[model samples]
Target chain A: MSVTKKDVNYVADLARLKLSEEETESLANDMNQILDYMTTLEELDTSDVEPLEHVIDLEYRLRDDKAKEPLSHEDALKNAPDADTDYFRVPRVIE
Target chain B: MSSSVNDNYEAVIGLEVHAQLLTESKAFAPVSTEFGGSPNTQVSPLCLGHPGTLPVLNENLVRYIIKMGLATNCDIARKSIFARKNYFYPDLPKGYQISQYDTPICHDGHIDITTDGVDKKIGITRIHMEEDAGKSIHDQDPFNTLIDLNRAGVPLIEIVSEPDIRSAKEAYEYLKRIKQIVQYLEICDGNMEEGSLRCDANVSVRPKGREEFGTRTELKNMNSFRNVERAIDFEIERQIELIESGGKVVQQTLLWDANKMETRMMRSKEEAHDYRYFPEPDIPPVVVTDEMLEDIKEELPEMPDVRKQRFIDEFDMSDDDAQTLTEDRYLADFYEEVLLHAGNPKAVSNLILTEVLRTLNDRSIGIKEFPISEERLAGLVQLREDDKINSSAMTEIYNAMLEEEKTAEELAKEMNLVQVSDTDFLEPIVDEVIEQHPDEVERYRNGKKGLIGFFIGQVMQRSQGKANPEMVREMISDRLEQE
Candidate 1:
């Protein structure tokens, strides 16, 4: 159940983060400690317990399929960090 | 190009199809789901993945997926949950797509496809409901990819097939059937070029007798049904050639370069589907009740296969004609509606198969958009059946009817295209034809019976295509014998 340096590095890479060596080492140690603390709950045997899917027991609330007007194109792109007038722009991506 | 490698090996194929549901609203948001809005005009806070916004499930989305599941003979799960498949792309503004992971809404269905007169059943692995990502236009911008969130949160159903398809042709048949079923259900538009429907293929090859499979590559970006077949065929040949030349087939994603007619390697992502799927906490588990299933089943339109068989049995339609007529639900509905007005299924079928279909092709319109009403088309068919118009005359009247907005009878007379069935009228034309072509008449009486056609042609031409050839034939024979 130990979080290894490789695991931290892989996850950080997926998140597009470039952590320094010290930060990576610290994240690995912190994740390991958290896993170690959570392992204490495993000592209690609950083989017959049903897995809980949700904290609340309520079913999903559904809305009728009627459509409402969406935000204006201008408003939709207002908060975009990088955008042209009509589009939210990002670094060039290929398939 | 050679058959040697192909003969020694066989390819296995499975298709994953994504069909955008035609719900009025987005899958989880209450915003419009219309296609091709001025970029981002269809986006809401939830669609844009703004903080503090939550999604409410759309009722029609569930109903439509259930209709599709029933149409495809899939078992609808009593309880289905949405899972978040985490990924990072500009198109995926949420950084995760809400999809069904472990328990798909429908499973264990089978679609029967016929290829070259041989029927094979391809097993459906699963059909799950999901939300679509935004549109990323890479070619439209030089420095940055443009994103249109209008497509984000649009409802989609992913239909995955078992690795049961044997060849590219079978895959094609299977895809055609999938398209037909979805279109029939009216759950989706089933348009591939417009991206309402999309497909990807998983391809692998093995020796004919080998039970195990080779490494498979995934193919994406095929925009049409033809491209799907061609891509699979090209991938199969490429894999076989690689193995033939002592190269190993690697499992990776390739893009179908339709212009080049070859598959090229897609730039590999940081990780292959490193999507860590988890249960979506926002949407509570959905429970499909028995009453819901019953309602969906009752409302499910008759699927293409069943309707096709019924057409064959009920109307005495040939298999090819039946297949063509039932290819689209609207077209089949138009045929049946015409039959309500016209007697003689064979005649109506012929008219639809030839003239009506030609108009549809030439105009590039669907039956729903066809200009001629069922009543008018039925009237045209009846005229031919009643020997009032020859086939060519019927065609002329049909073509003229396209723009005039007049009934078939009104246009028939206006265009002088009706057959002159009266013996009294045709006899004069027959007399003129016989008197002018005495050599042909003499030859006809001397047992050159085939010259009757020449005489009939002359009479029709003289009458300006108005004389009934059958009546003219009978009178000419009697006159020739008597004279």
Candidate 2:
């Protein structure tokens, strides 16, 4: 399971990251190493083992349907990079 | 042009509908899930993806999904797991959506719909719970997109249907049935324009005899049921045209432009999201116990199909009328309530189908907002049944009732719209009509039996529309015939 330069670029595009050619090459190598390390699990022959989804065995810790108070508009947008009135402003995205 | 184009090809369509649940709070946060709040005011630390906050599943969310599952006859999974679908967008504050990936809560359900009087079953592939993303308003500003996190943590259930729909009309029927079921269960409001209920269709076309499936494209941006049908039709035609012109159908995502009535490419498969899903660690797995299933099943309201059948059998309604009446839960309830008072199902159904529905459409209000009470409507129908009012008089009284705050009987009396069936009172008016229209009376005696209608009309007009038309007819005929 080796990661190629094209795979790295495709993933980077999906993540909306801007990477240079040099960085792309270096990232490809780094991802391939991680993939190779993950391949070690395939060597284990545990055909009967059930796949684990979570570390804990807990189930159904739920809250009631009643609503609680939420943040004020100012508090919610306090940490935003840019805000206008009551909205967080970002670069225009065409549909 | 369409016949030749569609003759050799057949369309295959499947729809994915996202219905936002009417839960009081966010799926995992305590923040209010109500729509139309000021921007960002509905946000909580858990919904905003603050570092230290953890998510707690909402009990009502689970119950709502189970209700849907039972309504659609889906097999509720004994154990279901929530997974984090990793994606990045400004509106997705967590950089991932908590959704059901491999282990959906419900599966293998089938919904029956009728198209052209033929029943067809569309298979439900799966129904999974998820959280919604926030709104991004692009047209609000010239250079910036505004984000509102009010909807970010709202609960949703995505219903995926099998590719069993054969045409645009079938797809339309199937979507309507889905909406009806959700609305019946009271889990979702089923308002497409408000974004509470949204749909995306997967459409493809193939030669009529081909057994293998053709390449398909996913269509989005259709906000209404009509748009969904139109978009599927347009996509099917576009695919067939491309194939006939020696071009291959490419799988992609397209947006339906309702104004232009065409679908434009949004993105191709290469740009599709590879949502790397992993089990959600913050929230635990949901287990449906036998008791829980029983409770949900008992609480499930009668679905649309069953109610439609009962209407046909019980009320002796036609299939079409029954279908229309049961399309909305509230409308069906209103029909039953009127039936209790009127004691005549067919008459009530007809009045509701024609008069009540017309009024509702004119005012753009639902049955919930209709001004006339069930008892009042039933009284109006009863008046007509009892020969107390003619059809025209009934219509007049009904229209007047809409404007006045009075019962049907009160309105009938105030407007002088009741039929005067008393022979003693109508005989004088009938004799006067006969005496004045001697030419018509002579014609009536000469076997021009249709002139009886003219005499009746004159008597009714003289009585200001209060004369019983049938009694007037009998008297006019007898008086003219007497030597």
Misplaced by over 4 Å in model 2 are A2-45, B267-271, B362-365, B422-424, B481-483
DockQ of each: 0.81, 0.73
lDDT of 2 by residue, B118-218 (tens): 99889999999999999999898999999998999899999999999999999999988888888899999898888899999999998999999999999
Indicate which candidate wins on TM-score. Answer: 1
Q: In terms of docking quality, how is candidate 1 classified?
A: high
**Candidate 1, B347-447: lDDT as tens digits:** 99888898889888998777888998999889888888888888789888888888888888888788887888788788777777777887887788898
The TM-score of predicted model 1 comes to 0.95
The interface RMSD values of the models, given in order, are 1.0, 1.1
- Candidate 2 CAPRI grade: medium
True contacts kept of 2: 0.86
